[model samples]
Target: MARIEKFEDLKVWQLSREICRDIWHLFEMTPLGRDFELRNQMNRSSGSIMDNISEGFERNGTREFIQFLSISKGSCGELRSQLYRALDRKHISQEQFDMIVVKTDSESKLIGSFMSYLNSANYKGSKFTKPTSTSNHADAQNPEPETQNPEL
Candidate 1:
Protein backbone atom coordinates (compact mmCIF):
# COMPACT_ATOMS: atom_id res chain seq x y z
CA MET A 1 0.00 0.00 0.00
CA ALA A 2 1.13 3.56 -0.64
CA ARG A 3 2.14 5.70 2.30
CA ILE A 4 -0.46 7.95 3.91
CA GLU A 5 1.37 11.23 4.41
CA LYS A 6 -1.54 13.17 5.81
CA PHE A 7 -4.85 12.69 7.59
CA GLU A 8 -6.68 14.10 4.58
CA ASP A 9 -5.51 11.08 2.58
CA LEU A 10 -7.21 8.70 5.01
CA LYS A 11 -10.52 7.27 3.78
CA VAL A 12 -11.95 7.19 7.28
CA TRP A 13 -11.03 10.79 7.93
CA GLN A 14 -12.49 11.87 4.60
CA LEU A 15 -15.75 10.07 5.36
CA SER A 16 -15.90 11.57 8.83
CA ARG A 17 -15.48 15.05 7.39
CA GLU A 18 -18.32 14.42 4.95
CA ILE A 19 -20.56 13.15 7.75
CA CYS A 20 -19.80 16.18 9.89
CA ARG A 21 -20.76 18.53 7.09
CA ASP A 22 -23.95 16.59 6.46
CA ILE A 23 -24.97 16.84 10.11
CA TRP A 24 -24.22 20.53 10.20
CA HIS A 25 -26.34 21.18 7.14
CA LEU A 26 -29.16 18.97 8.37
CA PHE A 27 -29.35 20.74 11.73
CA GLU A 28 -29.39 24.13 10.05
CA MET A 29 -32.63 23.34 8.25
CA THR A 30 -34.53 22.13 11.30
CA PRO A 31 -35.91 23.58 14.54
CA LEU A 32 -33.39 21.38 16.39
CA GLY A 33 -30.97 24.21 15.77
CA ARG A 34 -32.88 26.13 18.43
CA ASP A 35 -32.25 23.44 20.99
CA PHE A 36 -28.87 24.75 22.06
CA GLU A 37 -27.95 21.72 24.18
CA LEU A 38 -28.74 19.00 21.67
CA ARG A 39 -27.48 21.08 18.76
CA ASN A 40 -24.16 21.71 20.46
CA GLN A 41 -23.78 18.12 21.60
CA MET A 42 -24.57 16.72 18.19
CA ASN A 43 -22.19 19.10 16.49
CA ARG A 44 -19.39 18.31 18.91
CA SER A 45 -19.80 14.56 18.59
CA SER A 46 -19.64 14.68 14.82
CA GLY A 47 -16.66 17.00 14.84
CA SER A 48 -14.94 14.78 17.38
CA ILE A 49 -14.94 11.89 14.94
CA MET A 50 -12.91 13.83 12.40
CA ASP A 51 -10.77 15.53 14.99
CA ASN A 52 -9.77 12.29 16.68
CA ILE A 53 -8.78 10.68 13.41
CA SER A 54 -6.58 13.59 12.40
CA GLU A 55 -5.10 13.97 15.83
CA GLY A 56 -4.28 10.26 15.98
CA PHE A 57 -2.59 10.27 12.56
CA GLU A 58 -0.44 13.22 13.57
CA ARG A 59 0.71 11.48 16.74
CA ASN A 60 3.34 9.54 14.76
CA GLY A 61 2.89 6.25 16.61
CA THR A 62 0.88 3.23 15.64
CA ARG A 63 -0.20 2.53 19.21
CA GLU A 64 -1.25 6.11 19.83
CA PHE A 65 -3.01 6.27 16.51
CA ILE A 66 -4.94 3.12 17.32
CA GLN A 67 -6.03 4.57 20.65
CA PHE A 68 -7.22 7.74 18.98
CA LEU A 69 -9.08 5.73 16.35
CA SER A 70 -10.82 3.92 19.17
CA ILE A 71 -11.92 7.26 20.55
CA SER A 72 -13.19 8.27 17.13
CA LYS A 73 -15.19 5.08 16.96
CA GLY A 74 -16.78 5.91 20.30
CA SER A 75 -17.72 9.31 18.95
CA CYS A 76 -19.48 7.57 16.06
CA GLY A 77 -21.60 5.66 18.55
CA GLU A 78 -22.37 8.88 20.39
CA LEU A 79 -23.53 10.47 17.15
CA ARG A 80 -25.74 7.47 16.45
CA SER A 81 -27.36 7.83 19.86
CA GLN A 82 -27.91 11.52 19.26
CA LEU A 83 -29.60 10.68 16.00
CA TYR A 84 -32.05 8.48 17.89
CA ARG A 85 -32.73 11.32 20.28
CA ALA A 86 -33.33 13.68 17.39
CA LEU A 87 -35.73 11.22 15.85
CA ASP A 88 -37.55 10.66 19.13
CA ARG A 89 -37.99 14.37 19.63
CA LYS A 90 -39.33 14.75 16.08
CA HIS A 91 -36.46 17.07 15.35
CA ILE A 92 -35.58 14.95 12.33
CA SER A 93 -37.58 12.70 10.07
CA GLN A 94 -37.20 8.94 10.03
CA GLU A 95 -35.38 9.21 6.72
CA GLN A 96 -32.78 11.58 8.13
CA PHE A 97 -32.29 9.35 11.15
CA ASP A 98 -31.70 6.30 9.01
CA MET A 99 -29.32 8.17 6.75
CA ILE A 100 -27.21 9.46 9.61
CA VAL A 101 -27.22 6.10 11.36
CA VAL A 102 -25.99 4.35 8.25
CA LYS A 103 -23.13 6.81 7.82
CA THR A 104 -22.07 6.54 11.45
CA ASP A 105 -22.27 2.77 11.39
CA SER A 106 -20.07 2.63 8.30
CA GLU A 107 -17.54 4.97 9.86
CA SER A 108 -17.37 2.84 12.99
CA LYS A 109 -16.62 -0.24 10.93
CA LEU A 110 -13.87 1.55 9.02
CA ILE A 111 -12.26 2.67 12.23
CA GLY A 112 -12.41 -0.84 13.65
CA SER A 113 -10.77 -2.30 10.58
CA PHE A 114 -8.03 0.30 10.66
CA MET A 115 -7.34 -0.48 14.28
CA SER A 116 -7.02 -4.13 13.42
CA TYR A 117 -4.52 -3.35 10.67
CA LEU A 118 -2.44 -1.21 12.99
CA ASN A 119 -2.38 -3.93 15.60
CA SER A 120 -0.93 -6.48 13.21
CA ALA A 121 1.34 -4.26 11.12
CA ASN A 122 5.07 -4.33 11.80
CA TYR A 123 5.66 -0.72 10.81
CA LYS A 124 5.35 1.15 14.06
CA GLY A 125 5.69 4.79 12.92
CA SER A 126 8.14 7.31 11.50
CA LYS A 127 9.12 8.46 14.97
CA PHE A 128 10.43 5.00 15.75
CA THR A 129 12.51 4.73 12.59
CA LYS A 130 16.19 5.62 12.53
CA PRO A 131 17.79 7.79 9.86
CA THR A 132 19.31 5.59 7.16
CA SER A 133 21.79 8.09 5.74
CA THR A 134 24.53 10.39 7.03
CA SER A 135 24.10 12.83 4.11
CA ASN A 136 21.95 15.06 6.31
CA HIS A 137 24.66 15.36 8.95
CA ALA A 138 27.38 16.08 6.37
CA ASP A 139 25.28 18.75 4.66
CA ALA A 140 24.47 20.40 7.97
CA GLN A 141 28.20 20.67 8.85
CA ASN A 142 29.42 21.95 5.48
CA PRO A 143 26.26 23.79 4.41
CA GLU A 144 27.44 23.47 0.80
CA PRO A 145 28.76 20.88 -1.61
CA GLU A 146 32.06 21.48 -3.45
CA THR A 147 30.46 20.46 -6.77
CA GLN A 148 27.96 23.35 -6.52
CA ASN A 149 28.76 26.98 -7.36
CA PRO A 150 29.87 28.90 -4.22
CA GLU A 151 27.71 31.89 -5.18
CA LEU A 152 24.07 31.65 -6.15
Candidate 2:
Protein backbone atom coordinates (compact mmCIF):
# COMPACT_ATOMS: atom_id res chain seq x y z
CA MET A 1 0.00 0.00 0.00
CA ALA A 2 1.13 3.53 -0.72
CA ARG A 3 1.87 5.54 2.40
CA ILE A 4 -0.68 8.22 3.38
CA GLU A 5 1.57 11.20 4.18
CA LYS A 6 -1.23 13.67 4.79
CA PHE A 7 -4.99 13.83 5.33
CA GLU A 8 -5.48 15.49 1.97
CA ASP A 9 -4.34 12.25 0.36
CA LEU A 10 -7.32 10.41 1.80
CA LYS A 11 -10.32 9.81 -0.45
CA VAL A 12 -12.76 10.45 2.38
CA TRP A 13 -11.20 13.84 3.09
CA GLN A 14 -11.40 14.76 -0.58
CA LEU A 15 -15.08 13.80 -0.66
CA SER A 16 -15.72 15.84 2.47
CA ARG A 17 -14.06 18.80 0.83
CA GLU A 18 -16.32 18.47 -2.14
CA ILE A 19 -19.36 18.27 0.13
CA CYS A 20 -18.21 21.42 1.92
CA ARG A 21 -17.92 23.25 -1.36
CA ASP A 22 -21.35 22.13 -2.42
CA ILE A 23 -22.88 23.27 0.83
CA TRP A 24 -21.23 26.65 0.40
CA HIS A 25 -22.66 26.90 -3.07
CA LEU A 26 -26.12 26.26 -1.71
CA PHE A 27 -25.66 29.06 0.78
CA GLU A 28 -24.61 31.41 -1.98
CA MET A 29 -27.29 30.46 -4.47
CA THR A 30 -30.34 29.62 -2.39
CA PRO A 31 -32.61 31.26 0.17
CA LEU A 32 -30.57 29.43 2.78
CA GLY A 33 -28.12 32.32 2.50
CA ARG A 34 -30.60 34.68 4.11
CA ASP A 35 -31.34 32.30 6.99
CA PHE A 36 -28.38 33.23 9.16
CA GLU A 37 -28.77 30.60 11.89
CA LEU A 38 -29.32 27.63 9.59
CA ARG A 39 -26.71 28.88 7.15
CA ASN A 40 -24.06 29.18 9.81
CA GLN A 41 -24.89 25.80 11.32
CA MET A 42 -24.77 24.14 7.93
CA ASN A 43 -21.49 25.78 7.12
CA ARG A 44 -19.89 24.65 10.37
CA SER A 45 -21.17 21.12 10.14
CA SER A 46 -20.02 20.66 6.55
CA GLY A 47 -16.61 22.13 7.32
CA SER A 48 -16.36 19.94 10.41
CA ILE A 49 -16.44 16.79 8.32
CA MET A 50 -13.24 17.70 6.52
CA ASP A 51 -11.61 19.47 9.43
CA ASN A 52 -12.05 16.58 11.83
CA ILE A 53 -10.56 14.13 9.38
CA SER A 54 -7.45 16.26 8.95
CA GLU A 55 -7.18 16.95 12.65
CA GLY A 56 -7.40 13.23 13.48
CA PHE A 57 -4.94 12.19 10.79
CA GLU A 58 -2.44 14.77 12.04
CA ARG A 59 -2.73 13.34 15.57
CA ASN A 60 -0.34 10.59 14.37
CA GLY A 61 -2.07 7.72 16.18
CA THR A 62 -4.51 5.17 14.80
CA ARG A 63 -6.75 5.43 17.82
CA GLU A 64 -6.92 9.21 17.72
CA PHE A 65 -7.45 9.21 14.00
CA ILE A 66 -10.34 6.81 14.38
CA GLN A 67 -11.84 9.04 17.04
CA PHE A 68 -11.64 12.04 14.75
CA LEU A 69 -13.08 10.03 11.87
CA SER A 70 -16.01 9.20 14.11
CA ILE A 71 -16.50 12.91 14.77
CA SER A 72 -16.38 13.62 11.06
CA LYS A 73 -19.00 10.96 10.45
CA GLY A 74 -21.22 12.51 13.08
CA SER A 75 -20.81 15.88 11.42
CA CYS A 76 -22.01 14.29 8.21
CA GLY A 77 -25.21 13.27 9.97
CA GLU A 78 -25.55 16.72 11.50
CA LEU A 79 -25.18 18.34 8.12
CA ARG A 80 -27.78 15.97 6.72
CA SER A 81 -30.19 17.01 9.42
CA GLN A 82 -29.54 20.65 8.66
CA LEU A 83 -30.18 19.95 5.01
CA TYR A 84 -33.59 18.55 5.92
CA ARG A 85 -34.38 21.70 7.86
CA ALA A 86 -33.42 23.78 4.88
CA LEU A 87 -35.62 21.67 2.70
CA ASP A 88 -38.56 22.00 5.07
CA ARG A 89 -38.09 25.75 5.20
CA LYS A 90 -38.09 25.94 1.43
CA HIS A 91 -34.54 27.24 1.51
CA ILE A 92 -33.42 24.57 -0.93
CA SER A 93 -34.93 22.61 -3.78
CA GLN A 94 -35.68 18.92 -3.51
CA GLU A 95 -33.09 18.23 -6.18
CA GLN A 96 -30.40 20.03 -4.24
CA PHE A 97 -31.37 18.25 -1.04
CA ASP A 98 -31.19 14.88 -2.72
CA MET A 99 -27.77 15.54 -4.21
CA ILE A 100 -26.16 16.73 -1.00
CA VAL A 101 -27.76 13.94 0.99
CA VAL A 102 -26.20 11.36 -1.29
CA LYS A 103 -22.77 12.89 -0.81
CA THR A 104 -23.11 13.07 2.96
CA ASP A 105 -24.27 9.47 3.17
CA SER A 106 -21.32 8.34 1.10
CA GLU A 107 -18.89 10.30 3.25
CA SER A 108 -20.32 8.83 6.44
CA LYS A 109 -19.97 5.31 5.09
CA LEU A 110 -16.43 5.94 3.89
CA ILE A 111 -15.34 7.24 7.29
CA GLY A 112 -16.94 4.26 9.04
CA SER A 113 -15.17 1.83 6.72
CA PHE A 114 -11.87 3.61 7.30
CA MET A 115 -12.27 3.35 11.04
CA SER A 116 -13.05 -0.35 10.74
CA TYR A 117 -9.97 -0.91 8.61
CA LEU A 118 -7.74 0.88 11.09
CA ASN A 119 -9.21 -1.18 13.90
CA SER A 120 -8.26 -4.45 12.17
CA ALA A 121 -4.97 -3.44 10.56
CA ASN A 122 -1.62 -4.57 11.93
CA TYR A 123 -0.16 -1.07 11.63
CA LYS A 124 -0.76 0.91 14.79
CA GLY A 125 0.14 4.28 13.24
CA SER A 126 3.39 6.24 13.39
CA LYS A 127 3.10 7.46 16.96
CA PHE A 128 3.22 3.90 18.24
CA THR A 129 6.56 3.17 16.58
CA LYS A 130 10.00 4.26 17.81
CA PRO A 131 12.39 5.98 15.48
CA THR A 132 15.37 3.89 14.46
CA SER A 133 18.74 5.21 15.65
CA THR A 134 21.87 5.45 13.54
CA SER A 135 25.47 6.43 14.36
CA ASN A 136 24.91 9.92 12.90
CA HIS A 137 21.61 10.35 14.78
CA ALA A 138 19.88 11.40 11.55
CA ASP A 139 16.63 9.73 12.60
CA ALA A 140 16.58 11.84 15.77
CA GLN A 141 16.85 15.06 13.81
CA ASN A 142 14.28 14.07 11.18
CA PRO A 143 10.60 14.11 11.83
CA GLU A 144 8.79 10.87 12.55
CA PRO A 145 7.95 8.88 9.48
CA GLU A 146 4.47 9.20 8.01
CA THR A 147 1.92 6.45 8.62
CA GLN A 148 2.11 3.52 6.24
CA ASN A 149 -1.66 3.02 5.92
CA PRO A 150 -3.13 3.54 2.46
CA GLU A 151 -5.34 6.54 1.91
CA LEU A 152 -9.10 5.91 1.83
Query: Who wins the lDDT comparison?
Result: 2
TM-score of 1: 0.86
**Which whole-number lDDT from 0 to 100 does residue 38 have in model 1?**
93
Q: Write the per-residue lDDT of candidate 1 for residues 1-152, one digit (tens) a residue.
A: 34465788788998999999989987899877877899999999999999999999888788999999999999999999998898899998998888889989999998998888778777677667655557676433332112121110
Give lDDT tens digits, candidate 2, residues 81-147. Answer: 9999999999999999999999999999989989998898776666676666767565444444444
lDDT of each: 0.83, 0.88
- Count of residue pairs whose backbone atoms collide, per candidate: 0, 0
TM-score of each: 0.86, 0.89
Q: For residue 140, what is the lDDT in candidate 2? A: 44
